[model samples]
Target: MSSKILTCSVLSALATAFLLDWYHKKFEVTTPPTKNTPRKPRKYDDSLIREQLSRNYSFLGEEGLGKIRNTFVVVVGCGGVGSNCIISLIRSGISHIRIVDFDQVSLSSLNRHAVAQLEDVGTPKVECLKKHILRIAPWVTVETHNELFDINNAQPLLMDGNPDYIVDCIDNIDTKVDLLSFCCERNLKVVSSMGAACKSDPTRINVGDISCTEEDSLARSVRRRLKKRGVLKKIPVVFSSEKPAPGKASLLPLPDEEYEKGKVGELSALQNFRVRILPVLGTMPAMFGLALATYILCDIADYPMEPIVGKSRTKVDGIIQSLAGQQSRLGNTEQRIPIPNNDIIYIVEEIFRGKSPISNYSTRLTLSQWDPAKKLSLQNIVVMTKEEQKLHEQRVLKGGEKLESVYPPEVIQLVEKRFAEEKFYSQFR
Candidate 1:
């Protein structure tokens, strides 16, 4: 009787298990899907994208909007500045972009990142940006690179898209220099963001050539490094002109336990990366990023923007003083310079674009008469390095030689092109 009972109990348990399994399969197959079921991806809608960008189209017009749609942009660094920049770019009708970043999102990033959330922590930043981009601009073609942008991998990362503009938001000094040096060497149009950390005043933000950037330590470091690499050409950059208040902010010290370890550098995310964190106000970087986007859009759309030229009035006077001294030594008694004192900055920055057309050198530059016979005027003044000016004095001005005889055809052509552009631009003035 006991044996019979045990066998019956085992049979009952087996039947229950079998029934449970069968019921699961039956419901899974027969039950209609609920709201929890993953839905198919929404199809791309061209009209929707256009309608969403209607305000941008209204602002930029048909030709500008068309250019924006066709343009490809590359953004290196998916942190504060870069994230905001790419967001603006996408919303403004940038159809294609390649985002390169080697960092994973951290909880700290939520304070400043454009689209990061609590769930995005520990994921690659480029992936986060791309995912967010798809949600708003589904038709946008996004290429992501989850790796460090260094000299070794920069070419492929930067050149693969054949981007019309490269926005450099990299914070690492060495990597920043490497990217800028590469772009400068390749003659690639790029705009870089200087240090926005430790700054809070948004009014001080300025966009100008890297040489003209002041009060930002990161810009100074980058400028110094680029100069070491023989890159003296003008590099457009968005930088803050506000000086950081002393004792207001600084790099956070490492924890005692971490400092006890001999390898502090190893503690960084990557080798040679900064272990200490710079205190960031968060809002400053957004301003920098927005400024970058505005500048790039204006540039792409052929919209005219006369940015505040980077130096102070005193600096402009210094340049004039240098030019005057050069003139005085030449012994030409033209009692007064034909060029207005206020117009010197325009001539140097606008007409010549703040660099010598001959060697592309930016330092020690001053205005010089292109032709001795022509009176000093907007059309006659040209930008040249001090050395080039001395040579011009010896050959063209004093020796009575023609410009074409002394300078190469390429140089003459570039100067002439600048003059022609000035002639057209002057109409607006």
Candidate 2:
């Protein structure tokens, strides 16, 4: 009726709008959903650091407790092997701790401070180990620096908590060789603690790699001062191969009004060679601080750990080549300087003691010999033989021990030609 039914209903409404746009582009339609889209939240944490490290879930599960809750340990000595290696690294779940030390809590550090007490003697061992690690991981983050870690604040307290391991337990061997050369020049990750003072076996404790330490004489003087500071890498410690024993407790030398009522500093002969009366047996620094928190939580739970076993096969260059062919009966050189001038035989017996023409005997035979081109010169008329001035006034009353030094003119020209003989100045002049 209208141009053939309106061109056949406009070709059936343009083939029903091209079959509904090809059935909505080949079937796919439900669209209503978009209000900040997100649906992935399978996380839960009933933290007590996961219920007291929930028995480290059959050996560190949950990806080793999520890498021990993002690792960061620092512990440079809090005392007694860094307070039992920070109490087995905060009860073995360490969730970021720092704890450097200035030291306090003394009354002789309660035998081997494991978070010491006696009302925490004088406190500040990083505030009693950060209040005993917040009474055991109060969602741990301990930190505390409390000064005295040396080398100008040890590289900003070891990269301001950038640590992933650094339990050195600092007992000052030049601040543990400047914090092991500042963590081997930024390669970081450290572990050190040699010489747990006059050790008491614990089966000769040991770990390794300060060049494979042996017979631990403080790891052979910290491996000869880290090989004179070039720092031959390999550092990793926890040493003790017996050999310290033998101390019968003798720090004697008191009486200055009983050593000023229990000494308060002023004993320096390098602090009496580091205050030794040496008996220490608080279970060998709590078993070398729980074997250095079991080598920092078993190398952060990758766990295979087994290197240190009965150390001391003894080859520190075969004990320094058995102390190099043993020759040192006081004769290395300097024309035979074996140290025995006795004030140039008491100034050549007061220029030949009592009587005999001498007038300082040619400046005392040019002060007994060894002028290896120049240096040993003794001749201020030093003659003392009334029992050598009564044994030098009882060795300056037993304290001023500086038994005079500089002597090397062929060891005082053999005690000045065996006491300037002419029948020994005619029998003591």
Return the top candidate by lDDT: 1
Give the winner by TM-score.
Answer: 1
Q: Write the per-residue lDDT of candidate 1 for residues 164-242, one digit (tens) a residue.
A: 9999999999999999999999989899999988888777789899888766788888899888888999999998765
Off by over 4 Å in 2: 1-63, 66-78, 82-84, 91-121, 124-127, 135-137, 140-195, 198-205, 208-239, 242-291, 299-302, 310-429
Q: Worst lDDT window (10 residues) for model 1?
A: 32-41
Instruction: Report the lDDT of model 1 for residue 360.
Output: 95
Cα lDDT, all candidates: 0.83, 0.61
Residue runs of model 1 more than 4 Å from their true location after superposition: 1-43, 255-257, 310-429
Residue-level error in angstroms, candidate 2, position 240: 1.8
Compute each candidate's TM-score over C-alphas: 0.64, 0.26
Tens-place lDDT digits, model 2, residues 161-202: 478888787766778888888788778988888877766657
lDDT of 2 at 53: 74
